[model samples]
Target chain A: MIGGKGISIWFFIGSLLLLYGIIITIANVVEMVSPSVDKQPVLHELNFGVWWGILLLIIGSVYFFSFRPWKKK
Target chain B: MLGNLKPLLTPLMASSSSLLSLGWVDSLIIIIYFAFVLGIGYYLLRFTKTGEDFFMAGRDMTMWIAGLSFVAANLGSLELMGWAASAYQYGILATHWYWIGAIPAMLFLGIIMMPFYYISKTHSVPGYLKLRFGEGASMLSATSFGFMTVFMSGINMYSMAIVMKVVLGWDIHFSIWVSSITVLVYVVLGGLLSAIFNEVLQFMLIWLGALMIPIIGLIETGGWSGMVARIQQNFPGGDYTHLWRTMGSFQDNPMGIHWTGIVFGLGAIISFAYWTTDFLVVQRVLTAKDLRSAKMAPIIGAGFKMMVPFIVILPGLLGLAVVMPKLVPENMVSAANPHSYNEVLPLMLARYAGPGLLGLGVTALIAGFMSGMAGNVSAFATVWTYDIYRPIHVKLTKKEESDSYYVKIGRWCTVLGVLVSIGTAYMVQQFASIMDYVQALFSFFLAPLFGTVILGMLWKRATKAGGFWGLFAGMFSSVGMWAWVKLDPSALKIIALSEYAKDMAENMYRGLWCFLIVVIVTVVVSLFTEPKPEKELVGLVRGCTELPSEGHLPIWRRPIFWASIVLTVFIVLNILFW
Candidate 1:
């Protein structure tokens, strides 16, 4: 039942990859900004919380506008 | 020739009393556990009515059972024992793994990934690949999964053998044979049903073992506060302090592990790939009675994961702080050395635990080992029978084949899987730590496959060519990066990097970078390629619309949508402050 054209599949795969890359980049950049002092122990090395939050926000917004759960044929 | 025989014979000679010293009670407990496992296998034989029954337990598993089994399957003896040992050497940084790496990743999978996966209703994770991409991607993913299974089997066997050698004084060869035979017998007799039921029992024993050690340690050293103070006195620099404080160093500082490595390097990728994509975990979910149960299983498993560090890792810290000082430095050194960290948990048990309780600890240890082994065997058999065999050789009306025929093949596959695993286990013995070896091998295959699979599922524009090429590119890049780090640690150094950053860059698995490259290349290629048909993409992404409505959400929004937002904030705040 589930099938797709070659180009759409490529786009989908590319976007997901890009999203992961962006998330990792953001996490790395945040780590650079909040560099830990030599004397104090580093509490958070990578801020996955922040990036994961952003991801949820994006996913949520897309779902909110596009979703039509109760729509009938 | 005589000298060669003596080297082997010496270990055998030493094993007798070591086995005997296990005490009659301990021996009886082990025997009983073995019998219980075999009994489950035999009892479940009747249910092996069809291939589906054997491979998936006829998809009748309840949420709680599936969830608990998921936890049990993942909590191999090596995991607990290795974690405890890490705590002994490094400190509380070990626990940070759960907070940063496991919990969030699991939650992500449960809410985001599972809905997509469940909608597809494929039997194996790779089967979804065939649907989304093509036969090439599916075949590649399945092959990688097979390789991983073989790798894991070897590591599990090797670790179990090490535990026996250290705790029970069995020789390496004897231990290997015993562990292999024990797993092989039951797996060959039953199938997933036996594996799951036995996992329930093993989970209980492992929990008992994990809980008992710390309780006994606390009792032995007086009480909670008394034990803490003693640990403080023994290990300076407050290494015995709270868990979060320990992420600074990799060496003697128990808590000073590089937090990035704990969360991102190992945690995010490994947990996400394994829980969301790997057959070992997915098989458990697929057997769930319905979608609700499948969704609930990983969530429950995550909750259980939060409790693990306290039970397993803390005691190892206690052992290092309070118990090991009594041991000679040479003995402790020999035991705690990186190459020998596997001995940490066993030595702690042998030295500290009292006689009657010692038997229970040993039983629990074996339970953990066997649970992992059985999970792997069953999963491998499922993949072989369902994904490979059924697709290639056996194509009939689903109802035509007698249930017994499917069941018979399931049992045969179990034997074949175990035999292959045993051979791999022997090879894995060359590695220093079983965990490291398994993780390293997994990263190579997992990251690239993950890139392609995520692309195919979520992105409508992704081409099969992109998916295929992206996977290869990711794999090659990851492997190349890994080789560079290993062969020349200083080659890829970036200026002004934090000590933790430097460590991550230096020791980071190349496979992760490979994954990144694959993703990048795949995206670039897809951008230039022609788009796929919308009709084909619809069901692949949006899922079946005709099914009876229960808890279905539109592809875009659900309550978990908001919850993920709020929880992410909470996790961040907690990490920052703590």
Candidate 2:
């Protein structure tokens, strides 16, 4: 652990990404329900936000748990 | 290669009206990132008691941490944005900077030079010079390095503000001050430890946040083959996709330079000088916990560096194939003519990213700029304390100060450096050309300093007098050569050895000449002066120093084994593209 409070850099990164993924997925879901009037990308129908968010969540969960400070003991 | 070349700087001048508008979600992501950086700094502060702890991350970084930080230190917003623009302007030829211009030198530093640096236990590059060459050489190096590093940090600050203003329509003052204060608080709290940790975080963020552009871009353009076809169709007969096919003659390529300049000037001299000698990157590797970790760090870095072009270079190429109305140079950009080469990254971000992803992309850019500024400022603090102030303090008082005293000085130096950087940011805002001139000036030092450093490390016969005089002569001639071209623009053709050689070619050839001058002068001076005894050269010069054997490890565990793999990949990639 590089941090004095027992938080590893990996854990920190994981938590941040996890939070971001959740926020993005939730936000995009809201947008899908009530579509915004702004111009979207070429493949806006693909729902890139959901898939990319899920990928981030998967990656972040692995990092967070793998190097969690609680796991150290 | 080693220094900030024209390709890297030209994009900064290209400005347009505010391009991408950020949502509240985007602002939240950026704020969270800032909060985390400061929180980490505060958390690390309890352990940052000693000078070593503050300045060297307590000398306990793993290969991953050091390696990521090493690569991230150079992955500044300027590079990411600039090279993207260059990739649009000059084609795949800009990839030379990340590949041949970097990998060989990174491997050289890890396998050969790290032993001397680690064994000698010098805190900074100038400290190594002081040990081998004497006070005169060290003072010159330290003063120049200290000034240039902090100044570059300021330029980074100013550049980030400009990017924010142009892309997001944020006030320049707000961008500069907020970012500067954030960097100042974190770095002043935990020093290099803070910087290193944030850099590792920045590396991952950059990949995750920016990777969407290339992925979505490829999907938009069909694929690599389809993208290439479109580029060919866009600019008929223009060699924009091939790396080496168009490098045979200056007229054949968009970059307007021969392969000789790329190989000899950039690959041999500039890459070696910057990778091996520049303290900004070297300080990251210097934080490794053990000799094995130290030796393996750059190898790990090289592996990641090879993939950077996917995110950085590909986007620009995709812009060439896809960006409508076509982008123009900075000089050509105006209110009526809005599209500039520098806007390619932001334009692409706007193209592919939605609300949350947009915030993520902007956070990545901010993280890059902050980390780069922190890297320079932290390195400046360490050099200022250990190389410049501490030596003079000891010499003047004729007594060594306490460790805590130096650590205190390091903290204060961090604050001082940031204030200086803020001033420099304002100065740059007033006159943009000053940044260009200063960056070019600093570039002159690296090649010649590399010449002196390599000689001192390998040749026991290199006298102290030879090191100082050689560095002075090399720097003088480098400046002289620059002035020669400035006075008469036609001089570039002669210096770069071709009528069609562009500004980039001139930078490469000038570095090559300065390197040659240092080697010649050092050799001649050493022949006439008294050499340091071989006994005194132990742990400093290669021949006299005994390297720790990695024979106990299995073949696969050796650093050289990994380095060999990286090198093989490098060569294969070159030939693949060739």
The C-alpha lDDT values of all candidates are 0.63, 0.89
The parts of candidate 1 lying over 4 Å away from their true place are A1-73, B1-20, B219-226, B238-240, B246-258, B261-263, B326-341, B389-409, B428-439, B492-512, B542-577
- Candidate 2 residues lying further than 4 Å off, grouped into runs, are A2-5, B1-17, B334-337
Range of the 10 consecutive residues with the lowest summed lDDT in candidate 1 chain B: B494-503
Candidate 1, residue B175: lDDT: 69
TM-scores, all candidates, are: 0.75, 0.96
Q: For model 1, how does the per-residue alpha-carbon lDDT over A1-73 read when each residue is reduced to its tens digit? A: 0011111112222233234334334543554477434221111333433443354346434533343233232
| Model 2 residue A14 lDDT score | 89
Interface RMSD of each: 19.6, 1.8
Candidate 1 second chain TM: 0.84
Best by TM-score: 2
What class would a CAPRI assessor give candidate 2's docking? Answer: medium
